[model samples]
Target chain A: MKTHTLSSHIISYVLLFCIGLFLVTFSIYYYFTRSTIQETTKENAVALANNTVNRIELVLNTEERIPEIVAKMLESSFLDRDSLIPFLKSILKNNKNICGSSISYEPNYFPDKGMFYAPYVFRQGSKIRSTMLGNENYEYAFMDWYQIPKMTQTPYWSEPYFDEGGGNMLMTTYSVPFYTYKKRERTFSGVVTIDISLEWLTKIMSTVKIFKTGYAFLISQNGTIITHPNKDYVMNQSIFTIAKENNQPGMRDIGRQMIKGGGNFASADFKSKWHPGKLWINYKGLPSSHWSIGVIYPESEMFASLHQINIILICLIVVGLFLLSLFTVKIIRKLTSPLKHFADSARLIAAGDFNVQLPEIKTQDEMKELYNSFSYMQKELAEYIVSLKDTTAAKEKIESELRIASEIQMAMIPHIFPPFPDLPQVDVFAVLKSAKEVGGDLYDFFVIDGNKFCFAIGDVSGKGVPASLFMAVTRTLVRSISDKEISPSVIVSTLNKSLSSNNESSMFVTFFLGVLDLATGELRYSNAGHNPPVVIRGNGDVIMFEKTKYIPVGLFEDFDYGELSLQLAPGDKIFLYTDGVSEAENVENKLFGEDNLMKVIGENVKASPRDLIHNMEVGLAEHVKGHTQSDDITMMTIVYNG
Target chain B: MNVLVTSSNDYTIVTIEGRIDATSSNEFEKSVMEVIEEGNTKIILDCSGLNYISSSGLRVFLIALKKMKAIKGQLKLCNLQPVIQGIFDVSGFATIFSIFPDQKSAMER
Candidate 1:
């Protein structure tokens, strides 16, 4: 009865469950996939950093060993300084990765060369140029490349610097100390050095790519940026200076760790003015130069695959849930379609249309069972309704027939109250009330001759149609016989013989017949098992006639009947009634007996016959209240006015 | 109304109970007619339990009487209450049909 639909409810719940499952599954899958991609990207960055470091180390190692080899050759008396210039020129010309090579002596340790004398050969744009160092303004003996190897008596690599004296480029010098035996003890000789331009290293760092936006950079032992993609900061900016300029102390910490020969992969929110977000940095320390190679990438670029995957996952879940909801709605619609039809059919049935055609369902499930039940109920209801209609129609037919029979019965009685209007000697009134549709009580009065009046009242043995028929027969017989026979007793006796002759129904009637002679004022009456009539005197005295011993008429043949004769004075009235009056019952089941009937008539003794009958009717009505009349009531009154 | 039938020898005793008015007279007719149709022409209507009878009830009896007469058999009425006997007397039906005060008298008749 509620307005909510079942399909919507089912679809909503199912879609909710599916979407919830999808969201949880997608979230977990996205989480693990993102973590794996990040780990793989970090490893890739580390490998790229390792490769760049190894390549730079290999170039630096080759250039540093060239000077050491030359110094060993001179110590073994392989060549002199005159031969070293041409050899250095040949070495510089032969090796393309090396920008230049210089052998700077420590204050002219060569005997052939004076103090502060140095020989250097460098590449001059596809040509090898030989030059001597140790000028007044640029003393090779005081330079870091010469001083460091002489003091440490070992091979050393100088920090990257601008070479203004010979190489004229950003270069790092690798120096090695040469020695010759003087007094059977090794002594420090001039430093053999090679100037390696950092241009090629910068090119290598730029070419080593980590993902899309990741690039590599080289930092020297003192945290100086040797080679960087941003060339402006390559020679001028140290890692500490860059970190301070960018307001990133975390970056400075990473720089310190890298320079200490520690390799690490870490992420930091290094807010540079140019790049403000987080960065992932993978740094490795170079073994040869104590430099660190760092592959730095922005966090967004490093996790770009993860971002793409998240977008794809969200799209997949949304599309999946949408399709799931569509299918769920469709399926639920199909399932509940029968229910909707059932509701429609039930509505029609409630509206009293039992002839509705229900939809058929063939599925072997609950819906089929439900449809069958509905059809069965509809058929049963229709049958019940039809049976009820038949019963009502039958009852109505009987009632109508009863009504017609009653009408015919009532027509049989003398309905006109005043029988003899011209005969002022008598005033008569009569009323008949049938308890059922047709009654057996009947009364008739006729003038036999000019001088005699014959009147009779009788009740048949039973009531309804058969009794009414008998009453008709008796009235006809009485009238027919009264015309030929004038004596009241003879008339009744003759009528009884006729009625009793062929009566096979065992039916009878209580009857009384009276004849009045106007000339003599004599009233003669015969009683046949009927109630005694009452004579009310003009002085309000009520007297009941003696009841006769004879049985009712129509019950016996040749039965002796008795007649009583009464002389009526002027203003005397005789009241005749059937047992229906004397036996009428009230609410308490008390009857309107003869005593009550006499009292009612005695009170209205002086009234006209019509008024007297009316008063008696009122009295009987009051006595009975509103209870059902058990029998037909028939009464007649005659007031003599002679 | 209820009709109970009992048979002995050549007579069927139909004991009718309650009032047989226009409404219940059809049932009374059916019961009595069924006995007549079964060739049980000699029948006794026991009215001991019958409180009243209307004209319709009388009609059923008449129909039964006619059927019995046609078959040259007798239909008797017995155990009539005073009120019912009074109806029979007033209608002058006491002479045409044989009636007895009890079942034994009716059976002998």
Candidate 2:
């Protein structure tokens, strides 16, 4: 899980939404704007075509009206040939648009003027000149202006022509027939005509403003191009020829509709020697001569404004989104600064630098509250750790003191295994173990007067320091008393009297004191309410001494103690122990009772005192495996080899 | 070991139970001495509930007996289990202390 920060998430989502919105809005705007520009360009083309047609119509209408008015004046009062020549010259002089005028009568209608008598007046530079146009080289009856008006008895406009005589120029003629009334019937007299130079019309068509790379062209009713941006097409190519050359049937169809004298606007893709790509053509028919005025604009040029606006809009949106992202990132960084500092502090705290200084936050917000909580937690943890360390130090001091006390207590007991090595008559060994740091169990043996060997093993009533002290007291009392008294009973009785008199704490000890007479192989022992010792004979017979039990010492003063004696042969051993051995418990809580103790002693009947004690300890250790010793264990073995 | 000490008139009845080994013998002694220290020196040890007694346990009873004699007070034993009576009889404890079969006789003494 790679994760983004909270502020980064916000910035990403906001930017995404903004970009999406911008795209949607821009798409709609572009579509409508493109359509609007297309429609506007189309309308502009149509308006330019219409305006060009109106100018052409005004010039053609004026030329046609002049011929008709002149025809009516000549018909009302017949003019002589000379007067007619002046009249035509004045007409050409008065109208700047008219290039020339002519009148051609029927053959032989005027006897004096021949069968084709027609006079023409035209402008050469600034001068008006007269010429006879009805000569054999110029056939008046075959001219389209003369023939059309004479046959229809109406006014007509001729196709543009380049005249080689009678005022040489490219021109279009408008003709009207004059008739005479005889006996309520009209008779055709002559054709009156006016020629308009097409140069001015070509100039007017070229002046149309249809953006750059756009042009206007004129097509006659017969589909011939009259005026065009390409000079080669003028008077040379038809609209249908250009359409076929461009391989566009749609352009041909527009040409057909245009030449039908019906106005229309259309667009088509036309590629020819003169034009390429898609073009928009708006054709309008002129009412005067049925010529169609067409305005053409390339689609690229027409939609150029739309493309420019689209690019601007896209650029603006991209820049806007970029700025938005920058602002979002800046705000997010500023807002999450506190969180970053908090995280750094948290990391330091986890690394165990609890006292690390946290960054201060002045804003009274959740971050400040969180900082305060962390600071408090840091202080509390430091205090708690300090107190815990102090408590541990105190506990360790007590434990070490107890260990020293245990050491001193162990030192007080007789730890030597072989006491009285010089006496070859007896060997003795003893071991003591405390359940706690210190214990009450004790064992001691010493030679008295070179002939009497006195040994004692005792169990004080308790454990630990108090019992240890009591054990030391009991051992001292027994040692001091035994030095003055040879009898075991006398020593214990005196020791009891000393301990019981001042026993305010009610502590006591179970003691067995024995005096061995080496010369006689006799053992005299006092048992003060203690478990009786076991004696093993040389014959492998184990005997438990069960005689003369007195109350334990340190319990009462002046209590008479009893003594028992046993005669031991050579190789006989006596085993002494506190109850810790017999009462030692195993994992099952079963005590190592006296039966087990006797069984261990009986098995090692031929063993020395050291071996006997070792065997018993091993047996007890095995029986109490995985269990704690609940009491003090003391064992002593004395072997008398007599 | 647990010692329950109850006094009736001049005599204190100390009921002992469980094992009075080296570790618990101190507690037994302290409880019995507390009764004696209160001037109830005419003590009777009821050993019917006493299952085991160690050498240290015997030392407490001996100290109690000596203290009673010094005070010129009597100490008696009653309701002793067979195992305890065997220990008393073999060690010649029966000779030193007055023993009875029941508490009534020990109290009458």
Cα interface RMSD of each candidate: 5.4, 4.1
Tens digits of per-residue lDDT, candidate 1, A599-625, equal 887688778888888998999999999
Scored on chain A only, each candidate's TM-score is 0.62, 0.63
| Predicted model 1 interface RMSD | 5.4
Residue pairs in candidate 1 whose N, alpha carbon or C atoms collide under 3 angstroms: A508-B90, A508-B91, A508-B92, A509-B90, A509-B91, A554-B92, A555-B92, A555-B93
In candidate 1 the C-alpha lDDT for residue B71 amounts to: 91
Computed on C-alpha atoms, the DockQ of candidate 1 is: 0.14
TM-score of each: 0.55, 0.57
Q: What TM-score describes the B chain of model 1?
A: 0.95
Top candidate on DockQ is 2
- Writing each residue's lDDT as its tens digit, candidate 2 over A254-274 gives 888888988766666466455
RMSD of 2: 10.1
Error of 1 at A411 (Å): 15
